[model samples]
Target: MRIAVAQMCSGISPIDNARVLQNYIGDAAAQKAEILFTPEMTGLVDRDRARAMAHIYPESEDPVLAAACAAAKHAQIWVALGSLAIQPIESGSEKSVNRSFLINPVGDIVARYDKIHLFDVDLDSGESWRESSAYQGGTQAVTARFGETVLGLSVCYDLRFPALYAGLTNAGAEILAIPAAFTVPTGKAHWEILLRARAIEAGVFVVAAAQCGAHEDGRKTYGHSLIVDPWGQVLLDMDTEIGVAVCDINLQEVAKTRRRIPAIANRRTFALPKDFG
Candidate 1:
């Protein structure tokens, strides 16, 4: 199937972001792409944490989500909305969930995955983020099947956890979607390396759409969206811009690679070492 990875520099307006995404989706459909994916914060990217909290709403009331569903129906292509800030059920507390949605061509939500790993890091460049302070982590892993291909869903910081990818592959995932708004520092250092590693380890195609350039909040993102084949080869890449890339993927590669390596079948459980007095 032909897939398109969309890279964007999202600002702090869901309406404007949706408009940009609509244009990109149209472009992808024009190129005959069967599936299209966008980066994290597809709805909006707000540097002001308080503003983000105030603007977040339940998924049912999110206009961006509704518009994306409509867009999917119009394009007749599966769309993986990277991630959106959604207000979770809370009693007198302000907490939201970083949620990702997979929409079918008919405008049906096929799967939803909340971000399990919240970015909580102190960068050496004086950029410190504590995502968990405002958002709650998800507890479940999700996968969806599109015809003959199985897709694994994950958000930004989840990429750091290899076991999640392993679990997805074990659950029969042939393609993995990693939608991210990776910081410039971390992305420059580890983005491609980690993506290639995951593809090689899982023996699955890795489609990573990323946020690029600087946002309205003075925060910069690393924007090298990529599609890596089972052989750890980058099939398509969008470097530092609002752009789209199309590539053809074959599911047969997953079987071929698994048969050649057979590593997943060889996995054995081991106990941790004890060092008690």
Candidate 2:
């Protein structure tokens, strides 16, 4: 399947971001891509908590989601809308949900996965974030089928959790998607290693589209969108650019890699330690 990974520097306006994404969607369709993958917070990426909250809307009313689905149906291509910052169902709530969606060719939402892990950390670069302060975490892990491939869905912070990827791999996921808007320090130090490790350990293809460059808010994001195969080989990597990177992938490599290593089947169950001195 041919997939397009889009790296964008989104700002406060959902309308403007949707317009930018429509251009990418049109480009992907022109390139004959079967699917397009966008980065996290594709709808909006403002650091100002109040302004972000002010513009927050539910999935039913989000203009970005509507535009994406409309474009997908028109292009006759599938789209992985990396994520959107959407308001909770309850009115007057302070926190919103960081949600990702899978839109089929018919412009229908086939699957939705809220980000389960919130990024709350202090970095050596003097960068700190408390994502949980503004967003609620999800309780479920989601996997869906697209055409002949089984897709595992995850967001930025979820990439650090190995157990989550293991669960998805065991649940019949052949392709794993991690859409992120990662900080510069962490992205430089741990991004590629973590992604390649996940693919190597799980024996599944890994596709990660990321936010690049600086946003209207003073915040900056590291952009190195990557696509790795089941054999732990990097198929394509965009080095900090705001553009579309397209590549063709074959699912047969997944089965071949799993059969050669067979680590998933060879896993040994062990009892947890109960007593400690």
Candidate 3:
């Protein structure tokens, strides 16, 4: 199946982001892509916690999600609306859920996965992110079927956790989707290597659409979107550009790579080593 990953610089307006996403969806459909994947925070990208929270809405009222679903149905293509900043349904809630949705061709939302790992760190470059302060983390690992492949859903910071990927692969995921809005520092240092490692370890394809360039909030992000095969070969690398990267993937490669390496089948459990006094 042909898949397209879209990279964009999102601002504070969900409406504007939705319009940009619609164009990408159209482009993907024109290329006969069965699925279109987008980066995290596709609805809006803002560093100011208060301002972003004030602007966000629950899934039911989000114009971005509504627009994306309409575009998906119109294009007759499936969509992975990477991740959205969603307000809580309950009144008086202090934080929101960073959520990802899988929309079918007819616009029905088939699956949803909230971000499990919140990025809460104080960087050495005087930059810091307290994502948990504004968002609630997810508890479950989710996998869904997309045409000829089974997809594991994760977002941004979740990519750093390999055990999550292992669980997804064990749950029958042949492809892993890691949509991100990565900071420039970490993206440059660890993005490609971590993605390749996950692909090699799980024997699954890794498709990571990303957010890039400078945002209106005065924050910069790394924008190299990538698609890696099960053999740890990078099929597409969209280096720091706002565009669509498309690749035709064969599901049989997942089987072929696994059969050769047998990494998943070569598991052995052991106890932790005793510490020397």
Relative to the true structure, how large is the alpha-carbon lDDT of every model? Answer: 0.89, 0.92, 0.92
Candidate 3 residue pairs in clash (backbone atoms < 3 Å): none
lDDT of 2 by residue, 167-214 (tens): 898899999999999889879999999999999996889999999898
Q: Score residue 229 of candidate 3 by CA lDDT.
A: 97
TM-score of 2: 0.96
Q: Write the per-residue lDDT of candidate 3 for residues 1-277, one digit (tens) a residue.
A: 8999999999998889989999999999999999999999999999888788777898899999999999999999999989999876764676899999999999989999999999888978797778888888989999998776799999989999998998999889998999999889889999999999999997899999999999999989999999999999999999987978799999899999999999888866779999999
User: What's model 3's TM-score?
Assistant: 0.96
Taking all chains together, each candidate's TM-score versus the true structure is 0.96, 0.96, 0.96
Q: What is the C-alpha RMSD of each candidate to the true structure, in Å?
A: 1.5, 1.5, 1.5
lDDT of 2 at 79: 95
Worst 10 residues of 2 by lDDT: 86-95
How much is the lDDT of residue 95 in candidate 3? 83
The segments of candidate 3 whose C-alpha lies over 4 angstroms from its true place after superposition are: 90-92, 273-277
Clashing residue pairs, candidate 2?
none
* lDDT ranking, high to low: 3, 2, 1
